[model samples]
Target: MQFGPFLKKSLPKYLFIIPAFLFVVIFMLYPIFYNIFISFQDVTIMNLKGDKSFIGVENYRQIFQDERFLLSLKNTVIYTVSCIVFQLSIGFLLALFFNQQFPMRNFFRSILLLAWMTPLVITGTLFKWLYDVDYGVLNYLLIQIGLISEPINWLGQQSTALMAIIVTNIWIGIPFNMILLLSALQALPSDVYEAAKIDGASRIQSFFKITLPLMKPATLVVLVLGIIYTFKVFDIILIMTGGGPVNATQVLPFFGYELAFVNFKFSLSGAVATIILVILTVISLIYLYLIRKEESM
Candidate 1:
């Protein structure tokens, strides 16, 4: 290989990528390395005792053995799955609803995007208030309708605490999915719908045979992106329930926080974070493979 000629040909492209490469190296790669280093050593905010000792796999082993860590893992998995199901389902229904010519369609579309546009912290606080046992809109409405005698402790109860957070996440997530799916629905060929109508295909039948299949790409995109978002969720759980009502809403990110800050176990926290990174990478690859498979067909 002619090194000089290769450099001459590829230098500009490399130059173009230099800024992004530097960014990744400085922000992403550096922090990843730092975390990995922290994972090997026993670290603390104060005395960095046991700094020199190399505790190989001890952190990983400890996290696995800990009941809290195990519960956090299970909760993370359940949270991801439940968030995906609810967001995708509600989003698809909303997409279908808006696909038809409706009054104030543009207004409704803007409102949906507005919800997604609001800051995460703001959303979390609002939801926290809404889930409050003593004074919440949900309980008030339910009471007015004679559905419940007393206000339900939405975030205070172990049974409903996790579910309350999931509901908020779904609300935060649905708008994005709806917008993407709505665009996809609009792009679908009207001729197909017309032909189906002529063939006496019912609305439900046309939706199943034509609409759903065409919306697969949009659905896939939403599902993968939503899963990623929900999996990494921290602020909502922290603000709403503090991963509480006895750790019912404790997902992986919150668990990482609790381990590192609350327990002051940097090594174990880093190990758990690294494990989460591996899982996320695997999930991303699977999603990419499925998307490609669907695209190829």
Candidate 2:
């Protein structure tokens, strides 16, 4: 009798999850397994050869020896950590500002969404134009204002190229992060502030004690997602510099593309992809564990 009732009640929820379940099974899970299989065998976009020999760990071994792969790993980690730090800091500040009562709040918030809602490809292209050394608005304006002795190559030299991409990504990311964090901030109870004020707690004290603690969930989510998204970055890199002027901006995703399509090393590419997946998986598990621990406290 209990089983029947529970099944009947959960039936609607099962229907709701069906589309998501199917999507993961067909897209995510299958592709991952297929990629693992692909990594074991030396296959390419054209080769119809069926000579299959099990080369255990050879692909991974090649990955460690490849300098580009190591550099890509280093670059991906730097880009991810940097993006998370700046994006979270800027986003939290903006979220706090928007959460407070202000004149024309809605108008300003709508304006902020322009960066978030704009297509990333369009943004990448726009930045590419902005960073162009000659006849570009940035160089033109800087030169006119005499900001520097000469026009800086924003996306050329190894030193400035990664920074340029980071600036563009942070600009695109901050608005979306601000919007989400703002929603969370608004949901915080006003009564908590009142009680803190009664205790003679300053705004700074209350923010540290109440706001920061409550925003833990949001911070954790953003940090995890930012790491993942930054690791897989490609569009802006492709549009802005294409990892040129040396390998300054060659993060993992672009590295994988260069190996697979540019160099036609399909087995090596698959191994690199699998390694990336493992790293992301480990990070995700750690984040989830931290989130659970936070909630428990």
Best by TM-score: 2
Worst ten in a row by lDDT for model 1: 44-53
lDDT of each: 0.87, 0.88
For each candidate in turn, the TM-score is 0.90, 0.92
Give one clash count per candidate, in the order shown.
Answer: 0, 0
RMSD of every candidate to native, in Å, equals 2.5, 2.5
TM-score of candidate 2 on Cα atoms, chains taken together: 0.92
Tens-place lDDT per residue, model 1, 135-237, is 8898999999999999999988888888888888888888998888889999999999999999999999998999889888878878878877888889888
lDDT of 2 by residue, 131-236 (tens): 8887678888888888876778888899988888888999988987898899899998999999999999999999999999999998888888878887789888
Per-residue lDDT, model 1, residue 287, is: 86
Which residue pairs in candidate 2 have backbone atoms (N, alpha carbon, C) closer than 3 angstroms, thus clashing?
none
